[model samples]
Target: MTNYEVRANIRVVFGDGALNELPTLLERHHPKSILLVSSGDYVDDLGIGDAVRQAADSLGATLIEDRGVVPNPRLEHVRELIETAKAHNVDFLLAAGGGSAVDTAKSVAIGLAAPEGTDVWDYFTVGHAVEQVPTLKVGVINTLPGTGSEVGRSAVLTNLATKEKFGVEANNLRPVFTIVDPAFSRTVPQHFQAAAIADEIAHLIETYTADDTDVDITDRLLEGALAGALTNAAKYADDPADDNARKQLHQISLYQHYLNFDRNSDWAGHPIEHVISGDYDLLHGEGLAIVTVAWLRFIAAHKPTKLVQLVSRLYHVDAVTFSEEQVVRGFADHLEALYGRLGLPTKLSAYGIGQEGVDIVAAKVTAGGARTVGNYYALSQEDVRALLSAAL
Candidate 1:
């Protein structure tokens, strides 16, 4: 038995026109002041800011707009938003974009609720206790489908000053309500949508590849998410206007988070990609797109069983017709082909990262006296360097 705990805390409003329920969701909180967090151009282009303001007006709540959030959510910007929320006495936070915006809002909530004179970054540090930190209520209007920050308790943020990226997990930081409107995904650029699909695939594979035994039920859900994402992603690529495909992908991204409840999953790629993307200001999903294959290749050398099963089931590779090594290569090549077809990066060099950059990222992952990462294979710094070099 895994002996894991499930936290079904977030409420979701799903379907087309779900954004209209933003006011209804906020009304339950009954906040007197609200901080609307998003990118300036995104909110302006989509009129999301105005919609939030109208919602606030309907609820008699004063709205404060903080439009400085960027992709890879910066720590300095989080600090600024924390101060802004404090100055306005914001009782609620409404994030109106994708993962970056939601993460920024979550970071701000953590910062705002910290005990006086305490640094918010401390919470992200390993071994830090975060019980009973009075986090503000957060609501989300998801304009993109990947990352699933809308319903997740973890938030990833970058510290530009230190050139490091870290993730913090606290139950209180999870959004109280999330609006998943498939129509909103249509407004996102195809490039980002492709990366979002890649992110969905990575999340599913990460959980499915865990070394834990007796996770058959969790494995089925993970496999189902993989199939659903792949089928819908291809449909989306063939016809970007397919509403059903978009809706399916959006819902899969949200629902897949629950699959992690009973699994000690392999997430070696995410931390490495986090450091690389934080350093280069790359799209988080695109970084994952590059690292996922390489990480799998490394893990396959040690734990080829799950991946072999994955390719056999998902890509229809026949175990009797092919060797395990060949099947693993087929999996990697097929994934790269899928991502390339979707117009995503398949190599770190695509983003101008090279041997030197790989060396830095390897060092960063092992920084602060850490020797390894990932529960499945436990990659050493040399392992990270070799795989990343091979990726390039």
Candidate 2:
């Protein structure tokens, strides 16, 4: 077992009626001004706007609502919100939707606190330390659960001008509190709901593939989470309104982040997808669904041992008798079927991406004289080209 320090600082109010706790949670901060950040019409459709207004009114705080955050969480929008927050003297930021909303609010909070004349993009590009800046407190009413941004310390943003997507992490970026109400989750569009489940599965598997060490407790916990996630995903597919499954799925996403305590997790697949989504404005989860399979195939070919272990543990496959190649095929086949069950497209061609698109994205992945993206596999520029080509 490796030495690790757990920073479990976020206060979580989770359950069926968790949204009602918004006022109580915000009252603890006693802010005079609040910024309610969200994506699309969910704020209006779900009555989240009204709820936030009521909560702010109850606390005698002035509320500024920005319901314009998009799916990819653009840097341009973050800049606009940061200016809005600064102008309003906003003391608190409330994210009222999914991971995109949470991340936008986080970017604005950190951007607002950055030193004078400091471009917020520096945080993502120039290794700016978020802890160095004094950021406004953030709270989340997480209506969508996949990315786990409500409890996570990292935020992903896309720079449309540069066609660059990147993430920044610091303990300070985490929400001070998160309210996970399954009722709100039930209102999510079925497509996004399926995508969210896929995203969580990818997160768990990505972390699991980081190392093949004998950390029995962590490994078991990860396997259990993956199993539970898969089971709930099937129920979700059967009936999107399965209340118990929705609630459990949300819990699985939130809790699984804690399992990466001492592991050097691999996230190579995400950058590949980030480039695709950043350039073409594709859904993050959708791109992930396609790229994750290709990434696994890369693993199966180059580093079969860890993937073989995952199949043996999760699916009860007899790796001892079967060849590694056979185990690889089983795992790959199983994942394709699972993605099919969720109604996700498994090929890049499903999104109209082809050889030319692959060439462009491959170049972008190794841009700025960079050699690789992930730590576990250390995929080279050529490896990235090959990987995207394989997905195509």
| Cα RMSD (angstroms) for every candidate in the order listed | 1.6, 1.5
Where does candidate 2 have its weakest 10-residue lDDT segment?
366-375
Residues 102-121 of candidate 2: C-alpha lDDT, one tens digit per residue: 99999998899999999999
Write model 1 residue lDDT over 101-125, tens digit each, in one string.
9999998888887888887788886
Candidate 1, residue 335: CA error in Å? 0.9
Positional deviation of residue 361's Cα in model 1 after best superposition, in angstroms: 1.2
Q: Which ten residues in a row have the lowest lDDT in candidate 1?
A: 123-132
Candidate 2 lands at a TM-score of 0.96
Question: Local distance difference test, per candidate?
Answer: 0.84, 0.85
